[model samples]
Target: MSPLNSTFFINDDIVHPDFFFISGLAGIPHTNYYYIFLGFVYAVTVLGNTFVMFMIYSDHCLHSPKYIVVFNLALSDLCGSTAVIPQVIDTFLFKSHLISFEACLTNMYFVLGFLTMQSFTLTLLSYDRCVAICFPLRYNDLVTHKSILLIIAILWMIAGMAILIAVMFISTLSFCKSTVVNSYFCDHGPIYLMACNDNTPSAVIRWTHPVLILWLPVPFITGTYICIARALLKIAASERLKAMKTCTSHLILVSVFYFPLCFTFALASIIHRNARIINLSLSTVMPPMLNPIIYSLKTEEFTESIKKLYRRTMIHITVRKK
Candidate 1:
């Protein structure tokens, strides 16, 4: 049987129930290697994102609105990684592929919610950079801490509501078809596809949701950066360099986070479903792991703060030993 069509059968006489089986990285050979590798990735993702949050919280110099936004992104990454990876580890390593109906829907809600929040957060970061670079004098006046917090509150509220609506729609569907999910995690597409009832709602959500969450912010972010680039041309060469430096880390993050998603969506029709699912899983885990590394390496401010934190930690450790 094809991997995509693979299903678990307890016995010919037994009936399948409501629980779904997550077929993680199907058709991949040497799954033990993948299990070990994914465990390492999850560990790094947790440690990296936690370190970013710690550095931002402990250091006052990194308390600017820009870094505050980064802190939020790190938190989202940490949450997203936590929500998806452990269950995936259980599914793949422990062979606990079966997940209850309610648990699957709950996982889908949080994973999708965090994914949407990350996209919106990136857009906010882009806007923040645009304001800092384009309207240097007005940045402090325009994007104050209060305003940023308000925006963040609104973003979270919107994300939560949107995902909740999607989940409610999914809950209404009767999943009478096979409960085998052709993915490593509980994603909307695979889960909804398994429903035997009319999939019009899922199809509608699949089509329209991306427009609102993904395409909408993309053009805005692109236009904002274009404006930033134009503004850079009008400034002094030194000022231009500094402005670009401020944006470099965010630019890298945007590329890393969005490119895979775009590629996955674009090539979804051509690629095998198993491959697509694997790609989606990698995209989900990779950004969380890479975000902190990009920020630590590219942003001089964060790098310096991290170095100071390291030295202080080492000193404390030595003092304790003595």
Candidate 2:
């Protein structure tokens, strides 16, 4: 029987529900406050990512290869937040916990896809820093805005396809046992756990998602930083400090984005399911809201760019007042 099409697996006893019940943060106390907080987070995430994208577009100085990755990261952050937060608010905060099967799958696509893209985008930034620091002489030739854009386009496809495949496999699972998805949203793990039929492929894909999204990128980024460290040794002390300082934001971003997620995944077996859900939700919402803030505050170019944009806006407003 084909796993992509569950028709062959179907029997009179097999059952599929039109909708799934999202048991949001069950057994967690005072969850409404948390959702309210997430609403605030959503607002910040939207504003921050939008501002970063606008600055990257308006400032010619930010039109470089590195900011291309920044732009992509902001874009992913925006979309990823939109994918996960609003539905979470609606589902749990407002008590709209019933999600149609199709909507559930759609949620899986975006929540997971943008997540995949977000991770890959960070790795892309590491590459940018890697090339710039380790291959200083050929940095211009090695990395360009055009090449970065192309890679981003390709990555979007890869992340999308990877998640799409997983969602497809999920669609084929017969939810004969239970339709209660114990998550804030349509989590791949929880959803597949509800399946009654052969979930071997689903199980493999479950691991595959983290492997591609987290495990692989972590090591690759580590290696790049190692190379960066080695290269730093040969440079003048003054230049070395400046180069290392430039990497601060990326390092901070990687730590914030990856560490909590890695921790949550690592302790999934030991922690309460509700705790895991909260951690995953926080890991999702926090990074997007923080990414633009970190980049603007940490990176010198972005700080100047924001000041320039602010000055221009104020000048434009003052001129209109006349």
* lDDT, candidate 2, at 88: 89
Model 1, CA-based lDDT: 0.84
Listing every candidate in turn, what is its Cα RMSD in Å to the true structure after a full C-alpha superposition? 4.2, 4.1
Instruction: Report the C-alpha lDDT of model 2 over 249-286, residue by residue, as the tens digit.
Output: 99999999999999999999999888898999999899
C-alpha lDDT of all candidate models, in order: 0.84, 0.90
Q: What value does the lDDT take at residue 170 in candidate 2?
A: 87
Give the TM-score (vs. native) of candidate 2: 0.94
Q: What TM-score do all the candidates reach, one by one?
A: 0.91, 0.94
Q: Give the residue spans of candidate 2 off by over 4 A.
A: 1-14
